[model samples]
Target: MSSFHIYGHRGSSGTHPENTLLSFQAAHKAGAQGIELDVQLTKDLVPVVIHDERLERTTNGIGFVKDFLYEDLVRLDAGHSFSSRFQGNSIPSLKSVLEWITSNSLMLNIELKNGRFPYDHLETKVLELLTHYHLYDRTIISSFNHYSIQRLTQNGCKVETAILLMEKLVEPWDYLQQVGANSIHIECGAIDEYFITNTHKRGIPVRAFTVNDPYQIAALKKAGCSAIFTDFPLVAMQSI
Candidate 1:
């Protein structure tokens, strides 16, 4: 059963704030076995953990996350929409997350959001960070951008990689095999039991994203999914 892992999507985003230390803490407390987070580099080449190209949705800041330096990003309030419970939280660096993640035997699935990867020194820099923390074995790199995953794997990262798809895929396993990825991080809206079955037959595990509803979680389990990423890790722990 591989322990039927629950990965907190952008941390326990439903209860705490999204993409902040508070959210990841809440997820860990909520009993998530892993965390699924996005990584985008700054102009200074800092790997910051966040989702979205723009900061408008989650934080009080405007403009692109990639355009800002690490100092500029750390000053913004990431928990603006979540009320007083998490008022001062800021978006954390990938380095910050690596330090905290070592306290437990938790797994990390980091999504590379940058395009045009094989990105000069970017892949090496990311690998250096993971190696610094000695977390290569406990981590899995994922991406919708196949090149990023390929670049990282080719550079001899000890971690495995996962392929992401937000749309319905025909012959998805072919994509996974071609990318040298053994796992699929599927969008919940586009998956079906047949997809899961076909993926499983190829010895690949399928995990759906952002699943919160009990019925949907039950359905995913019945459909033989390997895992799920959820905003509601607390709800998921209960449902699963």
Candidate 2:
């Protein structure tokens, strides 16, 4: 149980603005070993750290992330909606985030946001960024889009890849193997003893997402999960 890792979901999102550098720093301060963030491409092809294809929810901007140029995206306030304390937080570029993570000696789980926007060459762009930073050894790239996962594998990325699943599969491990994924990221509701046991049988670990409650964390830990992705990593660290 002590071996389980705590990954900051959207980088301490419960407290700070999700995907902002401040949020990531807060997660690291909370003692999270890894940070999980989403990436989407701007109209000008720059990769930025953000969760949604649409900007309204996360930033004080209108329209889809792909519709905005990189320069314009930078002008939006990503933190104000969260609170006054984080008023000017800007959306971070993947490059910036990578540098921060490298300096802090933290692991990263980059979830490609291509599932919703289908940005052209998103996988390749992300791979290039990881390679530029020499972060493959410490990064796990995941996506709900199995095609994106396959693309990364086919491109010969050595970074660990995981398939994100929101529902139960008849044979989750088999699907993971077929997709060439090294691990699985299952939604908390989809986790069960059967899935965990079979994944462990195959020697691959499972990760749970959006887990915050102490009881839920304890249950997932008891079920032998590899890690828990939490918006409240501070609370998670304290609870465990």
Candidate 3:
């Protein structure tokens, strides 16, 4: 039987701090086949692994992440707020995560967090890094901003593209082709037999996000989901 691919959401975020190297390492150790993480650019235009535009939520820092230089941002503890055990963990660069992905032969979903803060040249910069590590083929670039997805394809990004959506679309397959996306990264609740069947017919896969429940995982697999993003990868791997 074919099983749904299990991707660690924010790198096993349920156990470790989200988007940190430790969290990614934990996810890999937990047997996740792939990992999904968010990336934002600093003031220096250096790509860093982080979820929010602001730093206060996940790190021991103040102000927007884009306001700081790469040198300054690395000093902040990215893990302490989650737990004392990870007090010294710092925000990792995209290079750092790329290295891990390459070394482990893991699939990567690099979500460009450019919806609110459209960092200049973010698409090119991210692509440059992926090319540097020769990981484009193994990577899937996704974004909530359809423009970014469009821009990636425009810039000759050969990496697979997926558009993240939270709301219903009248013609999702049309939109997917318009943006040159090979897959749809969507809210788990929005997926059902009809949605799956329609997209599958077009040769597009559907990946559900942030799913944690065992029953939901099983149902998604039964519905022929291509993969599932979960905070608890070990649990998802075991349940499915």
Candidate 4:
């Protein structure tokens, strides 16, 4: 398709409370075909949807997320900004997100938040959760951690995997192919026509992240990006 598919990066974060159920619903309302979110493991190793390592920025809780168990993390108010609009909204589990995605027929980009502490079973757990929700085909699991993506790919999981990056490389597609990834999504600041065309020539889809600028978003489109991730889904729809 010539029109690039739009995804709500953390669920239309510009309009609604970010990473909250309300945000996902708002993203859907904004005509986003896909929803992208980050996943981190709690102390109990329960996969919870969040971005940062600490809860202080988005929630009422203090301290690193590694210090808290899944039970405690989910109890904290995740809808701090839109408290009135989404009272009692808490950090959701992968299972919950999977259910929501499947129920709404939304494509999903599942980004694995990398961290220390001997992360085991993270790839398996994510695959299992997606399988439990019957979303193997509709979801794309992505990460900057190459090993994590390799693990998921080796497990015979049917989901697509994308390599995420920030910096520019001389041969971007060759670099990604070395890691066995067929898709690459880079930060908007680092994307260029050469990078896009090189990646497309390798039979890999190129996407740009967090692009909100109308002119820059148009540039990414002209560069042959298969999709674009943005916090303002409505603005993206308007542009694309």
Candidate 5:
């Protein structure tokens, strides 16, 4: 296997329902070194592994995820929308994912989805869970909401934190230093050899997101990216 990390974006989402345990297991079977997943608090303040603030996109449930309690959220079919083969797969809690992860050596990148609805104590809650599971050393916390990332650093969080970006910046490393972030997780197109090389010169790692094309994957790897988040881990692994 290549030294470059290939994290299954939402756990092999290209082949399975995103964020479900089934998807996670598939990523593992495909030899992914890590998995990147989204985290948001349920109505009950229980953190769950999902990508959206609303349920309509990935789940059978209606309305916002904040309106449903964890118990109610789990009862809904999380995978049926993807395919009939995944008819019974329910939304996995952060706790459940942590428990499952104990059985494997996969590293985790947990993206705090607080940009839409800022969940109360989301940073502390996720930190507590990581503490309980003894996963702080193996996890990387990232967020589009730089405030949450700042909160993690200000509170002296032990886990590595990365800033998620959608656009190119003149000097992203300066922004990273300002936010006290450990690394960068950016849109794939926004990164190139110069960007990756310059960022690495500052001793910062850059990981691109949602990169699925084999050509792009090879290019990023050649550019010396620390990692690439892809929906097809097997294809990425093969490309490298």
Candidate 6:
């Protein structure tokens, strides 16, 4: 197996505000090779980097994110909730994140949060932005909504796509073939050495999510995981 990649979950979320540009920058500075973030379409169809459908958890604002326009969403204090030091930091658009990413060599994992509301044209809009930035080669689009994954593949998406799984599936490689996904991004607890080795034999890579414990990180690396998403990129990097 090759060296396992470490991706900051929501950009070093353990120390910084989740999904804000500050967190992303911290992740890069912490020696993370990649960053994983979530994408949700605003009311006007602009793609923004955030993990929740509701705004109260991560921002000073209240209500659903889909109910607000990008102009309004950008004004919210996205960083204050995490710490007073991050006060006045605004929410970042996917375009802004892409612009920042252009200066670095970090691999991007964009997880679409459309399972609840099923935002229209979300797959198309995200693809457009990735194309505009010419980042398809280094980007991986994954979603818990398998329909969205299928849609991207059916529309002939050029970049790699991974199906996000929360539970163990029987013969997941067959499901990957059915969905036209290149890999799997599954919950950490659901994956083991046998699953990773079997999936590797089928030419499918397994990337675990939200892994924080040093022992689990090292174990996954030894198990031949392609990558791991963690809130503490620096700690994860040190583990292996």
Best by TM-score: 6
TM-score of candidate 1 to 2 decimals: 0.93
lDDT of 3: 0.91
Evaluated at residue 165, the lDDT of candidate 4 is 88
Over the stretch 1-240, how does candidate 3's per-residue lDDT look in tens digits? Answer: 255698999999999999998898888999998999999999999999999999999999999999999999999999899999889999999998898787887899999999998898788888999999999887999999999999888777799999999966877999988887788999998876778888888878889998999999998998889999999999998998
Candidate 5 residue-wise lDDT, 1-240, digit = tens: 136899999999999999999999999999999999999988889999989888998888999888899999999999989998889999999999999998999999999999988897789999999999999998999999999999899889999999999989988999998999999999998887678878989889889998999999888888888899999999988998
Candidate 1 residue runs with Cα over 4 Å from true position: 115-120
What candidate 6 gets wrong by more than 4 Å, as runs, is none
Best by lDDT: 6
Over 4 Å off, model 2? none
Model 4, 168-200: lDDT tens digits are: 977877777677776888888897667766677
Judge candidate 3 at residue 230 and give its lDDT.
97
> Which lDDT values do the candidates have, in the order given?
0.83, 0.91, 0.91, 0.82, 0.92, 0.94
Q: Show where candidate 4 strays beyond 4 Å.
A: 1-3, 81-87, 115-118
Q: Which ten residues in a row have the lowest lDDT in candidate 4?
A: 115-124
Q: Could you give candidate 2's per-residue lDDT for residues 1-240 as a string of tens digits? A: 338989999999999999999999999999998999999998889999999888898889999999889999999999999998889999999999998877878889999988876887788889898988899898999999998898778777799999998999998888887888899998999988888888888889799998999899988988899999999999999887
Q: Give the C-alpha miss distance for residue 41 in model 1, angstroms.
A: 1.0
Q: What local lDDT score does residue 182 receive in model 3, on the 0 to 100 scale? A: 81
TM-score, every prediction: 0.93, 0.97, 0.98, 0.93, 0.98, 0.98
Our model 5 lands, by Cα RMSD against the true structure, at: 1.4
At residue 3, candidate 2 shows an lDDT of 80
